[model samples]
Target: MTEQLLSIHELTKSIGSIMPVKGISFELKRGGCTALLGPNGAGKTTTLRMLAGLIPPTRGEIRYGSGDGHTDSWRHRIGYLPQYPKFYSWMSGMEYLSFSAKLSGLSGKEALRRSREVIEMVGLQQAAKRRISGYSGGMKQRLGIAQALVHEPELIMLDEPVSALDPIGRREVMDLLDRLRGEVTVLFSTHVLHDAEEICDDMILMVDGEIAEKGALSELRTKYRQPVLSIDVEPGEREVAWLDSLANRPYVQEIELGKRGAKLMVTDMGVARAALIQELADAEIQLLRFEAGTSTLEDMFMKVVGS
Candidate 1:
C-alpha cells in the first residue's frame, strides 16, 4: 500500500480575528494530484501556508506523516511554491535553485547537480544564468517550481501557481504539473474550475472557511448523476406543455426549461427517450433534434454551490 503524505484534522487558521480556514480536514495520499478549489479570499492561501509550516495553525492539527527531522531524511522531501513567488533581483535562476538545494541539505556539488536538473525540468536551462529580475511572470513562476523541486521532494504543494499567467503560460505550467503526475504527490490550490477539471484526480471544494465538498471528480458525478436529454422542437405551446408534463412521469427526474425547448433528466435514459419521443410523435410535434447531456464539473459546482 502507498504511504500517506499529508493529513489534517480540524485545521483552523484565523487572521487577526477573521477566520480564514475554519476546520478544514483532508488527507493527501502519495503520488496523486489533489486540487483545493474556491472563490476569491476563500482561505486557500492560508490553508497552504499552514501545510507548509509557514504559520502554525490557530487551532487543530496538521500532521506531516513523512517529513520529520533526520539525517538522510524525508523532511527535505517536501516542496512548497507560494502563490506570488519572490526572488532576489541579483541572483540568477541557477543560483537561486542552487541555494534552495543547499538549504535542503545537499552538498555543494550535489546542490549544483540538482539545480541543473531542476532548471532543465522547469524548462529554464536556457535562461539559467539570467538574473531573476529579467524574468517574466511565467518564467518566475516556473523558477519558483524549479527551486522548490531542486531537492527531489516527494510531496509538493503549490498555491495558485497559474494565477499570474497568460493562457499559454498557464498551459505550460499545467503541462509541467502533468509531467509530475506519477513522480510526486501534488496538492495545488486554484480558483479556476477548468484547471481542476483538467488535472485533478480528486478535489476539495472550500466555501466560506470550510470544506463544502470533497471526493474524486468521478465519484461526485456518480453520486449526483443527473443525466439530461436535450430536445429541440417546433414552436408550439402544446409541445412545451406536453414536455412539461414529463416532470410528473415516474421515470423522469426533472425538466430544465430552456429558451428554445427543454432538458430532461432521468434514470434509464433509453426508456425515457423512447417514451418522450413517442409522446412527441403522437402529439405531431416536429422533433428538430435530440441529444444526451452528461453532467460536467461546471454543472456540479453550480449545483453544489447553488449559484
Candidate 2:
C-alpha cells in the first residue's frame, strides 16, 4: 500500500473573527494528486496556505512522516505556489528559479542545474532568459510552477494554478499536471471541478467553510451518480405546466427547470419512464426531446455546494 504523505486533522483557520476554514480534515497519499475543490469563498486558498506552512493553523494538527516531531526537515521536502505568485520583474525566468532553489538551501551549482531542468520541464526553456515583466499571463504562471518544482520537492501545493489562464493556457497547465501525477504527491486547490477531474485521482470537495465530500474521483462519481432524465417540449403554457408538475411525482426526486426543458432526478428510472410516458401520451404533449442518463460530477458538485 502507498504511504500517507500528509494527515490533517480538524484544521481550522480564522482571521480576526472571520473563519474561512472551519475544522476541515483529509489525507494525501504519496504520489497521488488530490484536488481541494470548492466554490468561491470556500476557504480553499486558506487551507492550501495552511498546509504549505505559510500561515500557522488556528487549531488542529498536521502530521508528516509517521506523525513524529523528531525533525522539521519535512519543510524542505515541500513546494508551494500561491494563487497569484509575484516575481521580481527585473529577474529572468532562469535567474528566478535558481534564486528560489538557493533560497530553499541548494548549492549554487545544484541550484543552476535544477533550475535549467525545471525550466525545460515546464516548457519555459525558450523563455528561460525572458524577464518576468515581459512574460504573458500563462508564461508567468508556468514560470511560477517551474520555481516551485526546481528543488524536486516530495509534495507540491498549488492554489488555483489555472484559474486565471485562457482555455489554451489552462489546457497546457492541466497537461503538465497530468504528467506530474504519480511522480510526486500533489495537493492543489481548484474551483474548477473539471480541471480536478481531468488530473486528480482524489478530491476534497469544500462548500462554505468545510469539506462536503472527499474520496477517490471514481468512487465519488459512482456514489453520487443517479438516473437523470431530461425533457424538452415546445414553448407553451401547458408544456411548462406539465413539466413543472413532474417535480411533485414521488419517483421524480429533483427537478431543474429551463426555458423549454426540465431535468429530473428520478428515484427509479424504469418506473419514472413508464409514468412520464403515460402522462405525455394522455396529455398529447409535444415532446421535442427526451434523454435519460446518469448524473455528472458537476451535478454532484452543485448539489453538495447547494448553489
Candidate 3:
C-alpha cells in the first residue's frame, strides 16, 4: 500500500460572518500529484492556506506523515507558493532563493548550494544573477517554484500557479510541473480543468466550500464519460427548428440548443448519430459540423461547478 502523506479531517474555516471552507476532508498519498479544483470564490486558496499553516483553521484536524505518528512541525516538511507571490525586486534570482532557503532553516552554505541547484531545476540558471525586476512573468513564477523546492520538502502546495501567465509562460510553468511529478508530492489548486487534467493523477473538486467529487483522475473520467453529439447547421428557418427539435428525440437524454447548433447528451451514440445523419440528408439541411464522442473532463467540471 502507498503511504498516506497527509490526511485532513473536517477542516473548516470561518472569517466573521462568512465561512469559506466548510468541513472538507481528504487525503494525499506520498509522491502523488493531486489537483485541488474549483472556481473563484470556492475557498481553494483558503483551504491551501490552512494546509500550509499560514492560517489557523476554525475547526478540524490536519495530520501529516505515514502510519499513526503525525507531527505538528509539518510546516518544515511542506513548501507553499501563494496565488500571488511577492518578491524583493532588488534581489537577484539567486539571492532570492538563497534567502528563502535560509529562512526555511538552512545554513548559509547549504542555502547557496540548494539555491543554485533549484534555480537550475526550474530553468532559471541563465537569469540566476539577474535582478528579479528584470525577470519575465514566467521567470518569476518559476522562481516562486524554485523557492518552494529549495528546502526539498516532501510536499509542495501551489495556488493557481499558471492562472496569470500568458500562453508562452503558462506552457513553460506547465512543462516544469510535469517534470517535477513523481519526485515530490504536489497539491496545487486551480480553476482550470485542462491544467489539472494535463498533470495531475488525482483530483479533489471543491464547489462552494465542499468536496463535490474526489478520486483518481482516470476513474473520475471513466465514471463521468458519456456519449455526446454536437451538431451545427447553416442558419435557416428549417435548420433552426430542426436543431431545437433534437431535444424531443428519445435517444437524446439532454440537449443544449443554440442559434446555429445543438449539443446533445445521447443515450446511444450509434442510434443518435445514424438518426441525425439520416434526418439531415432527408431534409437537405446544410451541415456545418457534426461530431459524436464521449464527454470530457471539462464537461464533468462544468456539471459539478454549475450544480
Judged by lDDT, which candidate is best? 3
Clashes of each: 0, 0, 0
Rank all candidate structures by their lDDT, best first, as comma-separated numbers: 3, 2, 1
Could you give me the TM-score of model 1 versus the true structure? 0.82
Query: What's the TM-score of each model vs. the native?
Result: 0.82, 0.90, 0.86
lDDT of each: 0.83, 0.88, 0.93
Ranking by TM-score: 2, 3, 1
Error of 1 at 70 (Å): 14
> Residue 204 of candidate 2: its Cα lDDT?
95
What C-alpha lDDT, on a 0 to 100 scale, does residue 183 get in candidate 2?
A: 82
Roughly what TM-score does model 2 have, to 2 decimal places?
0.90
lDDT by residue for model 3 (1-307), tens: 9999999999999999999999999999999999999999999999999999989999998888865444448888888999999999999999999999999999999999999999999999999999999999999999999999999999999999999999999999999999999999999999998999999999999999999999999999898889989988999999998887788899999888888999999999999988989999999999999998888778879977887
lDDT of 1 by residue, 1-307 (tens): 7687778889998889699999989988888899999887779999988777778788887666665432224457678998878798799999999988998889999999999998899899999999999988788888988887888988898999998799888888999998988788899999877888789898999888899889888887687666788888876887677666768888777777765677777787888888887887788887888898676667767755654
Cand. 2 Cα-lDDT = 0.88
**TM-score, prediction 3:** 0.86
Model 2 agreement with the true structure over 105-223: per-residue lDDT tens digits: 99999999999899999898998888899988778888888888888998999999999998888888888888888888888888888888998999999998898999999998888
